[model samples]
Target: MLFDGDNDQKNKFIDHSMWNRLINDAKTPLTKGVHQFQVDLEEFLNIEKPNSKRGDLKPINVIKKHVSGEIAMDKLEELKAIVHGITSV
Candidate 1:
């Protein structure tokens, strides 16, 4: 099964028992804080509910639409800062 397949179709790619253990670990307090940063970042970028069918509407595409235009200068700087902050962490 391919990675793009539905969950059931991709089950063959994983060790279910080990996957279950990882899922359980994800619910623990230590892992909870780690995942929260991802949620916050997605919300900050307005891509928290990304739709595969509308890739062009995402931030990267939006930024690309006006990268060379004056209107995008401030936004581009803001985006650069956010990206750098994430990478630095």
Candidate 2:
């Protein structure tokens, strides 16, 4: 079925199964640290809970914060690594 059709219609193109594994494991933080990071990162960026805007500016904001020294470079690198790991799944 189309993903996020009930909330973020723009993301209706995504298949539900493609995201099911992540959502299913989200609450089990012991093995879902990446999911937890995603949740917290979205919260920190004032992002909405929908993936409709696939290219949201929140990540860019995080980068901007890093460049402006609001967030440390090491932490930014950690975020990047985590993001890469998650998306590569």
lDDT (Cα atoms) of all candidates against the true structure: 0.42, 0.49
lDDT of 2 by residue, 1-89 (tens): 11122222235566544455546555444543343332356444343443546657656765666567776556667666766776553
Worst 10 residues of 2 by lDDT: 1-10
lDDT of 1 by residue, 1-89 (tens): 00111122225656645544455456544332222122223343443334768845555654545554523456557656655554443
| Clash pairs, model 2 backbone | none
Count clashing residue pairs in model 2. 0
Best model number under TM-score: 2
* TM accuracy, model 2: 0.34
